[model samples]
Target: MEITSVPFLNPEEYSLFCSFFQDFDNDGETSVNKSRKIDEKNKSLSEILEVIDETEIPTSKFEIPSSEFENRASEMGDWEQGRVRKGRNQSPATFHDGETAEDGGGQRRRLWVKERSKGWWKYLDSDECSDGEFRKAFRMSKGTFNMICDELESVVMKKNTMLRMAIPVRQRVAVCIYRLATGDPLRTVSSLFGLGISTCHKLVLEVCAAIRSVLMPKYLKWPDQERLQEIKTTFGSISGIPNVNGSIYTTHISIIAPKTNQEAYYNRKHTERNQKPSYSTTVQGLVDPRGVFTDVCIGYPGSMSDEQILEKSALSQRSKLGMLENTWVVGNSGYYLKDWVLVPYTHQNLSWSQHAFNQRLDELQMIAKDAFMRLKGRWGCLQKRTEVKLQELPMVLGACCVLHNICEMHNEEMDVELRFNLYDDEMELDSSRGISVNALQARDGIAHSLMHCK
Candidate 1:
């Protein structure tokens, strides 16, 4: 038998034919010829078809059970490929009984057991989940968390109430307060804790108020008799010199205007202009030699001098508090209430032959000044910022004194030796100077009496 062959068209001829026949509706084998022409217009399609001609497709409708097909595909490492390419119209040769296509992807579903050994479990154990996850897990909003914390705090204050609120509230509040006390910037703290900046600021203020209300009265107070004795005992233990002279050390009240542009400019020209300035309120405090504070008063205008403030101070009403009349106050020249004030120990009382004695007295004053400097360095200078109000002043000063006492008690090895040597030198100088030993003794006796009475 003789086979007829069709002539193959050149590329240009095929292109022209496809362009013409793309819109053609010719029927029968002529249409198939036109389709062939369109396909041949692209050389890439021709090359692809050449490769496809070399491959084979299965002719029979063969049935391998789904399980068996999956096992075979797994062995061949084509299970994922098969699933990805498989069509919905064509029944798949393999099936996973409980598995579904996870979001129409190549990924296969398996039994998810929430394995505690891997993945999220590590983060969960470390409490290191992201904020979103934490919020979801705790079933809380940020506002809800704050409200819960407030509720817990209220319960803690009530004392007699049952713990109806959750414990997480207390834990969260403590964490918030700790961050605030560390002086972390509100914005940074808020971002870290997933809180608003305003919320963080409010939380800090409220927590500070809570601490002041709850802890101040119980832990901080004026130096009563018991506290004075404690202070005296502490001084004696470290200094080896008992506090026999318990003079009242009164601090001057000076309240300048708060730092501002106007104040700064006014201060610069005050002397030149001979300007009288407006002042804030005063802060008055009475301290002992051991730095134990008592009998604090405030609220006078700052324009008043130290003498005026002291005269009006509640310290003058010693008799009302059962305090003695003979208590001498060691103060600066501003407090020269001749009968009541003891100025810095004077050297004028020494005789001409007691030259070395005056020098020795000067040395003792220098040592005391150095000790005061050290104490000032530790406790810091008293400024308007440290003074709160009249009633609150005692507690503030008492807290500072307690801290000073702690340092004196625990870290006084060097200070004690220095003070002892200075005291001995001064005592020798006092004898040589023909200083009124009887009067000095009497003053000391009065101080000692006051210390004992307190």
Candidate 2:
């Protein structure tokens, strides 16, 4: 009630206090009427507190002695104390359309300012950053990144608000890309992108979802009738294997050992061979002649062999329904010999024709292997164990595969530094050697023709 006893008022506080005098000083009002007007104003206490909050008043200007507050607090009963926080915004001051100034939470939400660092992100986003630096940081050329952002803009874009502008789609995408490219922890990504750690994590998942839903169906999909014919012709020239639609390979992406059914995700082969613990999920990809994935099956447990993964894959289901239509997809010895699938012989002794056939077929398989290497290399998230949960790993993996296809389609070359040996320290799946009666004849015919031609 006494301005002289209080510290200095900021402009908002000064204006607020001045309004009381301007209202109460009007001449003909009874005490009861004046009190009722004051009560009506108090009904908008929530919004008034908000206006006060916008003024960054120095704490030093408002500090009260601890002993004075302690003495007052000791005198207050529970009902009075609770009243300090009650009934705000219940009869809010509304605008023409009845919108209130503050949220429905009233005074329940804590008021504080968060200071986020922007130095790293600022440099990375500026012209002073060299092309090499930008590429190294985000693992893609500026053009490629821009193209991806444009493709996802409609879905990944957010609406702005009165309090703060929404982060631009490019920046949101950069946060996601940097996280995926470097396999950085959310803490590091947050600092680099000037975002909260949880925000960084959320951006990656959101962008990955966008990529899966929007870009993946366009960039990564099974070949059509014409595309299949082209692929078969290309494979025929490479290894004299006719009707070879694509080369398929399965690779494991490392993940945190999940709590439920840990053994299911355990890689016994990798653990035994490397003499250490390992956990992963399987990603089976069928790549065309240019090493771009046309079909991918992701999120199978790491313990599943390539044969088992293939069986569970959509590719197998389609093949069983005669969708493949007598075309062949070649895999290594880890897969079973089937009418629509070809595998290299794995016995200790092999005839000259069988070895020749194996070598030629292996050349096609290597296309897929090399593609996997570049996929892991360019998207570093797939190289190391990721923090994404088991259930959501599919979107992340599928996003990587789609991006890899986009890069390949664009003729984007991987910087030599990003090259990774996916096979190094990785154990191959045990061969399942299942045989089909008709497959042997098909393989024998191809091997004889190939041997004779060579």
* TM-scores, one per candidate: 0.35, 0.75
lDDT of 1: 0.41
List RMSD in Å for every model shown: 19.4, 13.6
Q: Residues 1-454, candidate 1, lDDT per residue (tens digit)?
A: 3334433556765565566555455555576777775566555456645655665544343444689778677645644567533432232222212223332443433332221122332352244666444333322233443443554475333221121222233434543443422334566656555445675555544544554455335433555667667655653443233332233332322234545433421222223233465334444444444443344454554444556666777665653565634434444333433334443334467443233322322332343344433333333323222323343444434433433333343433222312211111011112243434554665454434434442
Which run of 10 residues does model 2 get worst, by summed lDDT?
104-113
Model 2, CA-based lDDT? 0.83
Residue 346 accuracy (lDDT) in model 2: 76
Query: lDDT tens digits, residues 36-87, model 2?
Result: 8788666555567776577675667566779987867754643476754433
Cα lDDT, model 2, residue 3? 36
Query: Model 1: how large is the Cα RMSD against the reference?
Result: 19.4
Off by over 4 Å in 1: 1-212, 224-283, 288-292, 298-301, 319-321, 326-329, 338-341, 345-454
Clashing pairs in 1: 225-454
- Candidate No. with top TM-score: 2
Listed per model in order, the count of residue pairs whose N, CA or C atoms clash below 3 Å is 1, 0
Model 2, runs deviating above 4 Å: 1-111, 424-434
